[model samples]
Each structure stands twice: as structure tokens, then as C-alpha cells.
Target chain A: MISNPLFFVFIVVLIIWIGIALLLFRIDRKISLVEKEVSEALDEK
Target chain B: MFLYRLVYVLMPIGIFLSLLWVPPANILGDASRILYFHVPVAWVSFLAFLVAGLHSIALLIKKSEILYREAMAYNSAAIGMVFTVLTVITGSIWAKVSWGHFWNWDPRETSIVILMLIYIAYFSLFSALKSNPNRWGISSVYLIISMIIAPFLIFIVPRVYPSLHPDTIINQDKKIHLEASMRITLFFLVVTFTLLYGYIYKITNKLSLIIIKLRSSHDI
Candidate 1:
């Protein structure tokens, strides 16, 4: 096994990757909702 | 289908984690371990552009609004940029260890720089179209031109020039010797990154569709 310090760096990179993935997911979801609202408003007009 | 795809992504992550304990010497070296990440990034980047190119061809043929040509163009360009960066980082590190320098003007390195520039221009063209809907057609045409150029840069350029980079599998003269364990680890890495690419592409394309809808509605 690698040293604890190297292992910690690996864990940190993994966590950061997961965090970025989650952020992108949230942004996509929010964008989708905004688009739906805009489309509905346009239809009303 | 979504759950299955999610499982596909997780499985590679699991495999990669398991392989980390297997010792660096079992592969090329402590440095060879980078291939587990580097080669896959290159492979997935090429695959992304191939997907984008196919979509471009489809758009040129069908001309359908819902065909997702623009989404493919944008998303592939994004992922390609990511992988290109990964390639540079890993390649530089490997070169430092293997060749005594970080940034050799090797044929492969130069080709990658050109490849990155082409895609950067592709993305810039998309940004330029933001102010003019009438330019999408022109932008799409430019993307098609990029697709035509990609194959030559990827396949032809490196072959035509003498390269200092070692080819593990491709070339006959300078093949790096890899143990069986290393080969298996590399295979898993490629699978993992390809799955990552597919997952991101799905998410981004969905997001792009929403943005397109939003823009169209705003214009009305």
C-alpha cells in the first residue's frame, strides 16, 4: 500500500471530482427548470 | 437504462480502486501508473470527437432541428478539451521521468497542441454565434470543416513525423514492454474513462436541449 499521505491525496482528488460532477448535475437541473418556465411563459403570450 | 448506465460508470471506478494496490513495478514503473489515466483520456477524447463528427455528418444530411448536432458539437469540444489537458499533464510527467524533459517538441506533442487549437477554435465559433442566430448555419459549416481536419491531425501528422514518444502498442520498433498486470490495469482505465465520457455527454446534451428551448422561447 502507498503511504498515508499519498493515499490522502488520492482521496482528496476523488472527492473533488465527485463534487465537481455533482455541481454540474445541479446546474443542468436548474437550467432545465428555467427553460421550462420560459417556454411556458412564451406559450402564454 | 439510466440506472444501468450509472452502474457501468461505477464498475470501472471500483475496478480502478482495486488495482491501485497491485504495485507499480508490476507495470512499467511508478510512472507507468499514469498510463492508467493518460491513455484512456486520449482514447476517450478521440472517441468524443468521433461522436461529434458523426453527428455533424447526420446534421448535414438530415438538417433536423431536433437531431442534436449543435449539442454534440459543443459537448464533444468540451470533453475533448478536458482530455487534451489530461494528456498534456500525464504526458509531461511521463516525459520528465522517461525522457529527462517535461515538454519535448515530439511529433505527438506537437500534434496534440494542434488538435487542441482546432477544437479551441471550434468552441470560439460557438461563442461567436451567441449574438446571431443566423450564424448557426455558418457555425455548423465551420464545425464540419473541423471534423474534416481532425482525422488528419490525429492519424496522419504523428505518423509522418519522427516522434520521441514511446508507443506501447502501436509501433513495432519502440514498443514499451508491459507486464500482464499493467495491461489489465490500462484496459480498466480506458473503460472507466469512456464510461465517464458517456455519462457526461448524456448530461450535457440534456442541458443543451434545455438551453436551446430557453433561447427559442425567449426569442418569441
Candidate 2:
């Protein structure tokens, strides 16, 4: 097992960064869907 | 779009360089790694606020696409709030490691807290005026006034009072304190985080625009 505490800190930071990235990606995807719907609605008018 | 993909890749590399590649500071040691995250987020927070302020000014001057401009400014402020909170949390963590206490009330710390409060008040005022027709103008003026005060809080206040915060990147002599490798890592991370902020701001702005469109069209 890696014993250094700094390593663990790095791991924690890594996990947080990855989590933020995933959250942003999900939000972007949802926004894209909404954007498409709005564009279609505008087209209909 | 390619730039958005680049954030996913560059961010991990930035993290790696910050935590592993750069040599630990002679005094702060490994705890200094937090600098990579803290400073970048703080810079982003300021950038977001500036963008919001500029958009507010444009909204007032041009007086066109009120919803779009208001949405951009609001979204910027929202992103800025998140990053400002991150800066506080990360700074507190660093302080705990360096000072053996979390809440030191150092000048920079106090100033940042006050800055946060100012923005929080702006947000509260925004929500309270939700039903008012002059909401956009009033909030934009509030933002502009706050922007005027922001520099005093961020730069002047910190300097006017002695603090436990470390030496700034650019010291009195106008020399960078960081060594070359660390400087490079810091710059890389700052750029990557700014790009990440842009990606997020873009998405949120698009969503807000769509909402405005739907509302205007009564198509929701």
C-alpha cells in the first residue's frame, strides 16, 4: 500500500476533479437537449 | 468543441504536474500543492465577475436582447459564486495545513469573505426583485457598483493589512517568487481552469437563452 499521506491527498483531489468534470459533462448534455428543442420550436414559427 | 474536449485531457495533466512533477516548496512542502487549485479558482472567480460586470454595462448601453444579456450576466455570477466558494474552501484547507488553524481572519481571508458576502447580497437582491419589471436594470446597476468596489477589496484591502497569506505571486519588487517548473505548472493549470470555466459558462448561457425563448414563445 502507498503509505505517504500526500498520495492520499492527491487521490482525493483527483476524485474531486473527476467528479466535477462528470457533473459538467452531464449538465452540458442536458443543455444540448433543451437547446435542440428550443431550436425546433423556433423553426415551427 | 475541440477546446471543450481539450479541457478533459489538459486538466488531468495539470493536476499531475501540480501534485507530482513540481518539487515541493522548501517551506510549505507537499501542502503547497493546493496552490494549483486555489489560485486558479480564485482567478476564475474574479474573471467571472468582470465578465458579468461588462455584460451588465453592455446590457444597459445597448438596451437590446435584455433577456440574453441578463442571462449571461446572471450565469457568470452564478459560476463565479461557485468558484469563489471553492477558493475559500481550498484556502481554508491550505491554512489549516500551514497555520495549524482553519479560521485565521487574516486580511486576505477577511477580504474574500466580505467579497463573497457582497455577491451573496447581490444574489439575494436579484431574487427579491424577481417580480419587478425593472429587475434587470436595477441588478445590473448593483453589479456595476459592486464591480467598482471589488478591486478595493481584492487588491487594496489585502495589501493595507498584514496577513498570514503567503507572499503574492508578484511581490513588491515585481519579481515572481515561484521557480520555473512550478511557475509553468501554475500557468498551465490556470489556463486549463479558465477554459473549463468558459465551457461551463457557455452551456449555462445556452440553457438560459433557450428558457428565454421558450417563455417568449409560450412554447413551454
* Top of the candidates by lDDT: 2
- The all-Cα superposition gives candidate 1 an RMSD in Å to the true structure of 3.6
Estimate, for each residue in B1-220, the C-alpha lDDT of model 2 and write its tens digit.
6686589889988988988788999999888889998999999998899899999999999999998999899999999999999999999999999999988999889988998998999899999999999999999998998788888888888888888887898679798989999999999999999998899889888888888888988854
lDDT of 1 by residue, B24-77 (tens): 754346555666777888888788877777777677677787336767777877
Cα RMSD for predicted model 2: 1.7
Kindly report which residue stretches of model 1 are placed more than 4 angstroms away from their true locations once superposed. A2-9, A24-45, B1-19, B25-28, B66-68, B131-134, B173-177
**Residue pairs with backbone atoms closer than 3 Å in model 2 (clashes):** none
Most DockQ-accurate candidate: 2
TM-score of each: 0.80, 0.95
| Per-residue lDDT of candidate 2, residues A1-45 (tens digit) | 269666676688789889988998898888888799879979989
CAPRI rating of model 2: medium
Reference-based lDDT, residue B21, model 2:
85
Docking class of 1: acceptable
